[model samples]
Target: MLRFLFDTIFMVKVAYNDAPQPWQLGFQDGGSPSFEGIVELHDQIMFYLVIILLGVGWMLGSTIRKFSVHHNQIVHKYHNHGTLIELIWTITPALVLIAIAFPSFKLLYLLDEVIDPVITVKAIGNQWFWTYEYSDYVNDTGETIEFDSYMIPETELEPGQLRLLEVDNRIILPVDTHIRFIVTARDVIHSFAVPSLGLKLDALPGRLNQTSVIINREGVFYGMCSELCGILHGFMPIVIESVSLESYLLWLSSQNSPPYSPLQKPHQFPKLGNPWGGIGTPSRGKRFYSTSSSSIDFATSSNEEPLPPLHPWFVTGLSDGESSFIISINQRGNGWTVRCSYELWLHTSDLSLLHRLQSFFQVGSVNLRKSRPMASFTVAAIDDLFSVIVPHFTNYPLQTQKRSDFLLWAKVVELVHSGSHRTESGLLEIVSLASAINRGVSDKLQTAFPNFTPYKRSLIEPCLSGLSPNWICGFTDGEGCFDIKITARGSGSYHQVECRFRLTQHIRDKVLLELFISFFGCGKVYIRSNNKAGDYTINNIPDATNILVPFFDKNPLHSSKLLDYLDFKQVVELVKSKQHLNPEGLSLIRTLKASMNNGRRAKD
Candidate 1:
């Protein structure tokens, strides 16, 4: 009998240690120090339960036998209740409860208390997936590492991997480090829980809840969204790969190299070091390639691996904001050369973006000008000028003052295209065309060709009567902006960042922009200055997130507008996550803001 009992106990112990087993009676063995404490607390509670059950069961059974009719049971003790018996009954139960409460309180305190965390991870729970942001770490090039971890389908699983639990991107962490997880939701509520690690916290929308854990062992731990978020909630499993510190650092270092596209972090990231050389570190031989699979746009890429293409419409929209076209008159030997140059400039921080843009248009050599904070891609070569630059603008036409310049510049290119620039007549025509270009003839052009009648062309009015999704998108591409305004509340960490989705148009088009207000089902059209172009905007968080976000998502804006929208969306999510309430969250919010529209720092 003793041997049998010992064997049963041994089986139970084995079942608990080997997790997720069928018919397991005990909890999975803990992998962290906190989890260890939790397991110990569970054991202690079970022991008390067992003791109480046995004592009560024995007493009842003995009383039944002694007082039964077969044993000549008698009625006794009619009038008086013993004070000692009452005291014993009340005190004894109270003592047991107190005993249980002490250990329980200790466990609760430990679970709630977050210790000094070396690293912070923001886990954003979406409808069917998890987006994890490593707020504390950046690659050698100062690129933030953030990624979305979608569960790998069964068909993609490799040998020895669990189905539905494995993910395309695993949360990698260094073992034996206290890591704080700031969990929140984007669209729905989710619960971030790992049984082995004894961690479970609700990922609430518009509410940031944080918990800390120090993984004491290295292994692949599987968990899932415990909350019933949506249809694919069960499919949204979490796979965390805990590794040695050195291995984790190696992975962190590799995240910045190749194939991954890095969004420029201009104002927020420290610009203390050289761009290629890295921020205060030696030049990492491998180049930085930011990927969404990371994170914050940086990831390691193999040389053979191809980079993703920029969407044509997106390129068009971005150009509408950041690009320029001009026909300049340059003083050269013997005669002034009429140079029709198309230049697109971006910040030095967005080096990858510039390269991507250059790759897309397949024209204009990307040049770095250290004197300016911006980098320029100029198409001075006449062949590239007509073939690439001119054709592109014609196909996807510009819609601003830039478009007016592009038209005059196109005329010059046409002359050059016709080889008419070789003659004196064509050269004089080109000079007149340059005078009519942007800002209406430079001071030098006026000085050179004194009393020269500037070539004049009527400004073409954009067709603004239409209200279809594409038309609205095109108009917004030129005239709209997604602005994230930050308001400081001294030292407090709440309500710091505010967002407004605005479209500006002349007051004459107040009725036209009002069409947008009607179409969006939110926001209002308000006249500013009673005459100048007014703002049709939605500034409230709920309307912006629920209404404006969905609209743009359906009729996606192209170009740099798309990048700005992405950053704007991230800020909306950060605010929703209640991240503004803490220092870490605030730091990350500021980092994201650095890459936002103009990185404007407006203090109120």
Candidate 2:
């Protein structure tokens, strides 16, 4: 019976040997003193424990000795006399504790210190898995590649691989290299910990925490997720292999392809219920609402016919006392053309207005028409459906030029598109106008009237009437006005000008100024010039007017009103006459011409 039992035990050992060893548990050469620092600290703690034990043992021995010597002979007890002894004992222990605490504090601070590392790796924790990225190390072409690490299952693991501990891919590192690690999570909280290296950090979703490590020895080490994140958390383990730089590089390249085959069957992940309210249903349908209060009844009776199609819309409550709207465009006809419109109710005309529309079926165009607070648009569809939206005032306009009104409007468009279901392809268009301005100005006029400045006021006040005379040339004194000023410079052949005037607010004021250089197109006005004579130069000069207009009918400058004021036309003639002169001379003439023309146009 004993022989049979021995044979059974031997068989069991052989069966266990057939199982794979954990990758992390395998022997490796990292370097000298691989765990010396931790070992030293542990030894120091053990030494202190031993010293305490010895001290306690000695005290007990002394008490026993004293008791044996005195036995029954002691007759008087004086508690007050022992005060000095009590003080000595108390102070000595306190001193020992302080001595221990000083080093402990130092060690803690050292652990917290995140030194400037030679390399940084980001570790993202997910349900029962971990993903790592070498964010700082990019290839010569600036491309970065990252991979996920998953544990190998017990049944398919190779020989010598430990069950529940072997991973498909090992974290490869160079021995003696300091590495900074950033930890984060994708869904729930997780922790990254390696006991041998004395490193542990929490990975919180949406937040990043950091720790550092330097492996002194080249070896494969094992670690497991320190935090209980899910049912499979215990199955997830970390395997790190530290090697020389050359070996590490080789291993890294080898990891381009995973060693083990992926699981044949799809992982049966637990269905996640509604985390916000703890609802157990995994595939709940989307809840729809018809009103902002979220109280509108959407339930349908069994006998009632299907309700009418719900027109989709989004309302964002803004910090300002107004809201905006977004409308989606749907493709209805056989061709790409599709039209959609919406009527907004307003209590007062004081509210601002904005619109955003998009299409999805096919690439198409958008057209917008506005009459006061009402707006209509037609979107040519490429795909199946399109969408549009309007939003309310969230912030004051142009309170600070630093605020990006256009970017904010873009976000509103995105919100509208994402809120709707569209099948067609189309373009998105956004138009915004303040309620106070009945007519919108052109891009050029807008550029000129930045911040609704004095120039804007000069033009807007007089041009509201369509029949305003040429104010720059003083052709109509109070009837019309124009204001022009140099706003910016560039390194090209032209300069930028801010132009504003009152034209009919309802009429399209945009005009293309074609430069008639002897009936030829000169390049648009640019601020920078190649003139050798260092004369007046402009950058980004438009294809329109070549002359500058500084003032309008209300305020005529004497230089502009004078016949011999060296206007742009006269300067051009003069430069032509001085063809033999240097480019600088020509440039000077051009500058004088631009200034005179600007002033003259304003007065005209």
Candidate 3:
């Protein structure tokens, strides 16, 4: 009996109370104080309306009944001269309007006034979906949590989920907390409106509209795009899961977790329930969605289930920046055993990504360094190097100067596979080729083979006339930089601020760096004479604001660099608004600049 009563109570507590009901005449239950106030103002106006309606109806009826020709048998002469009735009718409405206007204005201003909120969520409307970002929180790697919410198709909807309203990801917020939503649209105009909370705001492109709300209770509320943006606009839905403060924090933590590392003991993660509702059970092989349509697949298993593979283009782009192809000569007895290996290193936080790469190529092992916060994926077996690593890169092709090094390394791999390392001449040739790759042949090998000539490396001729957006995005995540520079102009008190988008590579990749000029239709390539390094930089304000900003806004970086990009973009906006001329705005820009890149790492 107790269990039955508890179940009944739970059912009643959640029974579609937060959603629309069939043939309902009134609004859904208000879950916010603002909505409650709106309701009160509505009722106040309705009360005055009822009184005016009754009074007018009674007066009309009395006038018709008393002045009828059949009853009075006479027509009133000089009735138009009566000023008392006219005065009463006009004055009564004026007094009623005055009473209504006060509360109406009060509620209007209350809705417009914005309080300082503890949490700020950025909601960006796209064609048919919503993108949300929590700007206040940063994970261990200095990355903010962001995700896209898409409506679940009717075919995929579960038992209790609402059609056209159920979304794959719901925006979670803490109940009773003052939260600010900064809304804007990416492509076209859309509206972010939740009827239950009385939240309705237009998400205009290129303009940010902000509103504050304090959820009064915990439950799931649904909303849709109220604007007629496009045909699919009806498909976009908004889901808000207001939960307790503790549950919200748990969800936040789960979103920004670093990829698992082998060096550390497995950390226990709190399970929140369904993947769409909470951080899904990792053991159940749930897939996490990125801001894009492509999902970042993650699964846990004890029976050796195959992990998801990464895109080949992404692999090539990352390898062009982070992977090293090396030929190392180690002493075995009195002779040398030259071995070839391909390696990529990442911060320990990205160990899971490396694991995915391993699963992608069907080779390599992930290992951790004992001395640093780093992990590596290495392919050292001769067969694996020749069959998997070599073939993958050959098919995808590296675009940077790394391609030159890869070519050299591939030669050494072939030599080792052919057992040429067993002969003196072949070993000398292998070492010479290795000498041209990363960290060149070790000092001992160079000292031993002092007379061997270094391999002649041919310049890599890129096949394509342009850069791929995905490849560029991935490569930027590794070698690209979004920087802000502030320096004094002349000897005056004024300062000059500049936003820089740069890609630097070794001189061998100067041709590749030059390609960026045509690729972006801006930016100049400068080669450092002393260091043989090439820098592709865009310093023109117009170019940075127009070309570079929009490009990156469309194809975003995926690493911690994203934080820097966001800051850079913010600085660009400040500069655009001429805010940097003021002391406060300059100081804010300086703070942002200082908190980026190395400053961000220092804070970490």
Candidate with best lDDT: 3
Model 3 gets an lDDT of 0.77
lDDT values for all models: 0.69, 0.41, 0.77
lDDT of 1 at 496: 70
What's the candidate order when arranged by decreasing lDDT?
Answer: 3, 1, 2
**Error of model 3, residue 482, in angstroms:** 1.2
Q: Which stretches of candidate 3 lie over 4 Å from their true place?
A: 1-309, 349-352, 423-428, 439-453, 463-466, 490-493, 529-531
Rank by TM-score, highest first: 3, 1, 2
lDDT of 3 by residue, 384-482 (tens): 899888898888889976888999999889999999989999998888888887677677887898888887777786644536876887778778888
Local distance difference test, candidate 1: 0.69
Query: Which whole-number lDDT from 0 to 100 does residue 481 have in model 3?
Result: 85
| TM-score between model 1 and native | 0.43
Q: lDDT by residue for model 1 over 1-604, one digit each (tens)? A: 6756987878643223423656867777677877888888888888989998998899899878887788955666584688998898799889989998998898889888776566688899987889988766543223357778888889888997777788889999877666789999998899998888888999999999999887867787778999999899999988778887556655664452222232322222222232112123221212222332222111122233546766555555556556777766666424666656777776554445566667787755554443455555556667777888788778777544456678888989989878887777787778787777766767776786675667776565544332456646655665678877777776643547787888886564556567676778789888886578778998888887898788888977643466678778877877888776777877777787776677532210
* Of candidates 2 and 1, the better by lDDT: 1
* lDDT: worst 10-residue window of model 3: 285-294
